[model samples]
Target: TKKALIIGSGIAGIAAAIRLAVKGFDVEVFEGNSYPGGKLSEIQLGEYRFDAGPSLFTLPEQVDAVFQLAGKEPKEYFAYDKLDVTCQYFWEDGTSLKAYADLNRFAKEVQSKLGEAELSIHEALRQSAFIYNSLAPLFMNRSLHRFDTWTNPLALKSYLRMGKLGIFSTMNEANQKQFTHPKLIQLFNRYATYNGSNPYETPATLNIIPHLEFNIGAFFPKKGMHDITQSLFKLSEELGVNYHFGQKVERVLVEAGVAKGIRAKGEDHYADLVVNNMDMVNAYKTILKDQRQPKLLLKQAKSSSALIFYWGVKRDFPELDLHNIFFSDNYPLEFEHIFKRGTIYEDPTIYLNITSTHKNDDAPAGCMNWFTMINVPNNQGQDWDQMIAEAKRNIIHKLNRILKTDVESLIEVEEILDPRTIESKTSSAQGALYGNSSNNKFAAFLRHANYSSSIKNLYFCGGSVHPGGGIPLCLLSAKIMTEMVEG
Candidate 1:
């Protein structure tokens, strides 16, 4: 039997294991933590449960695809409900909007709430849909490098139409031109953070994210977002994928420009293929020490990390939905604080997610679980404790002002995740949520290829590699990597 060694048990690693095992390979995963699901995890605080990462689930079809590949019905292993109310927004300027899953209702809501042009909304979505249909086959479903980029006609069309992908202009620039309302613009601009990029700096191509959420629709798993990992783990286990918990891969064993296997916990395990689902940057600096490393890939601009606080509230608010956004007074200024100054903004745009709205069992009866997050710079030797202290005070004040409630007294439990801890735990470079920032126009192409062109039998799949981060993309990255292996 062919042996495939996976370096980490992150979501992508677990997905890759399932793919390879289903394809007739013997798979073994080595994880540093006792648990699987790197970011797609949960934390238990007192009597409350919260999804540690990816609070709002979107594009669940990508998740179901994995079960189908394993020759199983998705409903048998996994299932999710489509959200009717996608998200609720509250701005410091006293603008509130309810985002519905239905386009007509949403447009009518936007018109009544923000007085935005209804016609413009249709045109922008039509444009966004065109972009999604055009690029999904080329950029998302397949790897950019290899023989396909040269010979495949679809890839060639993607290459020719590259300029129109809207990478050159910023998202703010696109929406401002597409619509008349600044509030609508601000609402749409927030999509840049879906991949952990700043709206003011990231390419307008990121506008595609809104289409994915507002048009294609968002969802919530029956259990919680973390159930995505749990269901996939259950599937991987059923497929006979072996897992080693509390095991860390110390190094990638390279012999004469080819990957031999991985060195983990003072022992060398033999394998024909070494699939590294760890962060791409760390894969080079730590594991590929003996090989010639690409200086450009190492120096690629990284995406912004986040400072998140998981608060178990003692009460629930009726206004909040599964997803809520409390906008800062100056949205652009917040991005400046992260990208330009490399510092956390005092009044950052706060994202508040209450999964208990849908899954009330996540918390005690009459209470809520809040996953509050704000974009911050990647780890660069900042004083996180001090920054976190100031941010908490500011966030509570901001939320109280917008939500018109006493926010502080409701917090019954708290857990914080900063860049320093995220880096040390997940091995992501500086704890960047996505591998590289889409700050630059070419960032999509700049991510490390799914398979190494310079090294043989070495591959990558995870948030820190090509096709990008977040739950759906990470799963897609694994699918792309396994396809490369099979071919």
Candidate 2:
């Protein structure tokens, strides 16, 4: 059997390992960390348990497909429930809205709360669906650099309808055109942040993000988000994929322009093929140092990073659910602070995720594990200690004002994950959650392809590669890379 070597144990890498093992290859996964799930790991702070990264779960079919591919029952290994209320949105001006999974209910809620017409909400959602349906197959399912992708009849039809995708205008511009109220427009524009892009500059084609959550519905693993990593790792092990923890790969051994294997800890491991699950920029700079670097691709603007405060609160608020968003009064100015100014906004849009709302063991009785996050620029040698201190003050003030509670007094324990820590932990270049920001129209084509254009028998997967970031796209990158490898 052919031997396959994988560089990381993230969801994408684990998925790829399982796929290759099923294909009759001897698969081995090398993970630098002691545990699996690069950013998708878990952390226990005092009595509270929090998913260290990626709190939200969507497009579960992608995960199910992996088990199905391995001839195993998905439910037997992993399970989740569709969320009825996707998120509760709050504004500083005493306004609130519940985004329901049912479009009709969501439309009525928007009409009642924001005073926007129901028909307008329905139409906006329809447009989002249209964009998703038209472009997902072309942009996401297949490699964009491949000629066969562009020549397909479906691709031609999608291309002909590109004008309707709002690719020419910014997401803010498109939202302003569609909604009369500022609050409604802000709600739609927030979707750009799903991939860490600025709505003010990113093309409105990204508006399709709303359809994934509100239309298909957001979900939560039955155990918690970390369970996703645990279950997938379990499945991979069951499929005979060997995992090497705490073994950091030092380099990708290339000879005469072909990838032969990898070198780690003063030793070499040979394989028929190598799949890199590390960040594309780091892979080139650190591992594949001998190979000619794609300077232009590496130089592309990086996506925003996150500053997360994991708090174990002494009490729980009934008004809060699995997911909640506290909007900044000025959305454009907030993005300006992140993308342009490279700092954190004082009144940043606050996201609080409490898995304890569903999983009782995540926190003790009457307590909640708060995964509080705010978007900030990627690490660029700023005074992060000072920034983190200032951000904490502002975040507490905003939460107190909105929730009518002294948030600081309720916290019994706290731990922080900043850009610097994220970079050190996951090896993501500059700790960018998403590899590259889609601030410009051409960003989609600029992402690193699944397979090396020059090197033979080498492939790439994960957030930094083709199809983009987030859980679903990361899984798709694995699928795309595996297909390229098999072919």
| Candidate closest to the true structure, highest TM-score | 2
lDDT per residue for candidate 2 within 461-481, as digits (tens), equals 999999998999999999998
Q: What is candidate 1's lDDT per residue for 322-428, written digit by digit as tens? A: 99999888888889989888888888889998889998789899999999999899998988899999999999999988888888898999999988888987898
How many clashing residue pairs, candidate 1? 0
**Candidate 1, poorest ten consecutive residues by summed lDDT:** 146-155
Would you estimate the TM-scores of all the predictions? 0.98, 0.99
Go through the candidates in order and give each one's C-alpha lDDT: 0.87, 0.93
TM-score of candidate 2 relative to the true fold? 0.99
Local lDDT at 186 for model 1: 86
Question: Model 2: runs farther than 4 Å from truth?
Answer: none
